[model samples]
Target: MKKPLNAPVLIVGGGIAGLALGIALRRAGRDVELVELNSAWNVYGVGIILQANALRALRQIGLADACIAAGFPYAVSLHHEENGQPQAARHKPSLLDEGLPASCGILRPALHNLLRDAALAAGVQVRLGITVADIRDESDAAQVSFTDGSQGRYSVVVGADGIRSHVRTLRFPEAMPPRFTGQGCWRFTLPRSAEVSSAVMYHGRQARLAGLVPVSPDQMYLLLLSEEPGNPRMPDAELPDLLRDRLQHFGGQIPAAMAHMPGPEGIVYRPLETQLVAAPWHRGRVVLAGDAAHATTPHMAQGASMALEDAVVLADSLDDADSLESALQSYSLRRFDRCRRVVEASVQIGQWQMRPEPGADPLALVREVAVELMRPA
Candidate 1:
């Protein structure tokens, strides 16, 4: 018989993964406490693309409809040549049972707000501007010391703290660290055009990739992926012009969008990085989820979806297992392969982009992965 998980669950780093886990566990009738290092709880990225699988996962927690309503839902991705000529259009089939759209594009803050509000409504205890300083896994529970000079004991401590996770550092000192993927991403927001109803990609020279995604009814975000030899960081004051220059080769609506680019403050830039820890994602009573265990490039747009699936599966495992050890093992076993596929595939696509093969088909690989992801997480 499985033992009931009646003890409190401590989730570190209240980002997408942590918040989703908090909501899932709380809905499962477990006590959950979430801590975020940032007091204001601000999100950095301009927008995110949620694929069908992500929406399916969100549906399990009653947030799928809300996300669909808030974001722009689309089923087709349009590909164009560097000079604005249409190349191809790929239509994605809906994975949801109720015929929901195949994908959604939403602002980062909007998605964060939805998850945060839902987590709070589900009765998660939230502590901001805090993080774990130390964690000692005892037989009965894991004792945690917070950076704010507070302490607590919980049945399990989950590290959803992201790629540079502190809890992961303390727990898995020997695990692999995050690696730079030799590429940088740039994003800028602009008014959505009437014709921009779906995701549009423009393949540029020298393997540069640019795309436009509608985030809402009236707003869309432009994204560029470029090879950065040393991952150089440009000054914030120079980001606007720099991004404009990078997109100079892209035609279509890109030129018009660039014309209205805001000052440096409007540009969002980040060097792509990825990490995937080898299995056994848990040690003692400490477990890692989301980017803490596997951080993938945005090439697949499955990073956040994978995190959401982790939260749901972890909660389900805990509820069905006979022991904490067995539950953690089950969760890791189920998640590792799926997450690894995404990380590897995404990295592979980025690598191919950096060094294109004569007959390599990234779009085909993407379609293959998308079909695989249509299965239940």
Candidate 2:
């Protein structure tokens, strides 16, 4: 096949990773097109916590200020258990003072809007309601065939698709698969007036975790996590009672917050799965990003942060390599090690959180230490 006259770079999946990649390529002066499978954006979850490292990645992409503004400065996380009083604390010098941005939390949809707006501002062509049917590379250029029957090519194709990435499966079937962590989460938006003042995580015997995060004066984000996969179909009439039952002992803001949990219609439940692809991230003009490459569990709340990191690094690796093949090699070199470490660490942490009984406290301690050491020095 012949390359188009003005073939723009193609990006599959317009979630955080894909959109970020489009933005990065645009900044690098590349004509880019991003195709999203969802008819529109789908970020209707709880708040996302951005660690200092995530902020640094946004800084590289120059979207830090806007993203930070769209989110509340969640400097500290308050953790408690059924019998323990909540403990409020901030990151120590080991991480925060290391130059990473203090952890900040943002409503999922709000952050999506921020990234989408910035992409438009950067001149990225974003197409929603579009699914990719196929992708190919020829004549040193990549081609993406969409379910919409349209075809386009570029010198590079970045698959920022998520864990269920069609691009990754179609292109690289042997790639590492998403591993179930035996964990799941349910997210909902509760009225802030209900009583959650800040971010809080309440731990339980089976490591059942419930949380609330205030995104604004009137709204708060609530998420409930369980040690095993869950499919609790909470009804409208039972939503509040259900949450109250799970979070009753979580002092401070949680109890009151659960009292106003959204009705069944507004509740969203999703499972937790992590992926590990420690191999090359690309094939000639094609490459992977975001969950397509590393779908991490939320144990340390670093999945999204890692995706942002992937976006920046993928873009940085393609600086004037001799060929598209060469550029892909560079992308893998820059990303595999960092991503592998994160994947391994997240798995360990998640396992620690979900482990049964007397083992919980000791596991949490180990996780805490590992997290501190992983932060940039």
Candidate 3:
């Protein structure tokens, strides 16, 4: 992939996808500038699981070692009864075959810090507390206006803003809004224990899904998924009691973890929602990627992974293709169906969990998706 001359690229949003793309492009000796709407550059949530496929993408940009150093690595996903008795353990399929763990769990901020440092080190100019106010695409270049009353011309403009993307609203006015998936997730961080080695999930007899994910050698986090009929809002003050009450059906390490709730700072609750942009992700020199293109539920744990994959693929496309149009088209063609499958499959899993039948096998659905994800995205 040869670098293009005078290809000043403007990327909106400095989250996972945006930052990763900045690193990739800069490492390839491309001129790129990234803008993030958040001035503080804060990242919410506790921990995230990086599946093998996500790790592969990160490896492409030479950040896998840093990620592993900052997170906990595990090769298995264990299912347990409410009493903490082991029910079944499914080992994730290894694609790299280089003796690396199949998946990893890391604190969200830790991952963010790593990516930010790498992006800065690669010479990618990052501007915070700014956003794109306007975008006009022409035959060979894109003119972008900033909220700070600044303008620039670039070979390409990427919208990695997120699900509630301003670029999506401005570029694709007819795009459908993200839909609620009738589910909400509750998370709490806790100290890691000797007994917790892998991602262990407890299946409550009353149809609740809760899990303890090890994020590091001495830290871990708990995640609970329950049905939310109307996508109700949850207040921060009530999150502790609500989470404790919901964990009553489970009897294992969950009780002990619940006992150590550290006020509102330790708890995070969010309603599950998803969105999938139709094909033709690019309009002339402006393109969309990551959550702006496809957002999914935590059921399949592929959201961040998808974003990382998008960054690597997009950078590669830009380098390999002959022209800006060719590069954006190649990036879209490579990512569309792969992302659609993940979004649809993740939503399907959430739906099945919402309405579990007497003989329904949720594990089968999970295994099917996991197997497919083991393949290159």
TM-score of each model, paired residue for residue: 0.98, 0.86, 0.96
lDDT of each: 0.91, 0.70, 0.87
Positional deviation of residue 76's Cα in model 3 after best superposition, in angstroms: 0.9
Q: Clash number for every model? A: 0, 1, 0
Better of 2 and 3 by TM-score: 3
What does the lDDT come to for candidate 2?
0.70
Q: What lDDT is reached at residue 218 by model 1?
A: 92
Model number with the top TM-score:
1
Predicted candidate 3 versus true structure: per-residue lDDT over 1-377, tens digit per residue: 45474658888999999999898888788899999999998898599999888888889888998998899999889898988888999887666585456899999999999999999999998899999999987666788899999988888888999999999999988889999998899997889978889999998754479999999999999999988788887888988988888888887788888877878877999888899999889887788989999999998888998999999889989889887778888998999998998898888777777777687677777678778877776
Pick the lDDT winner.
Answer: 1
RMSD of model 3 against the true structure: 1.5
Tens digits of per-residue lDDT, candidate 2, 109-139, equal 8878878888889999988888778777788
| Total clashes in model 1, counting residue pairs 3 or more apart in sequence or in different chains | 0
TM-score, model 1 to reference: 0.98
> Higher-lDDT candidate among 1 and 2?
1
Q: Per-residue error at 46 for model 2, in Å? A: 2.8
Cα lDDT for residue 213, model 3? Answer: 94
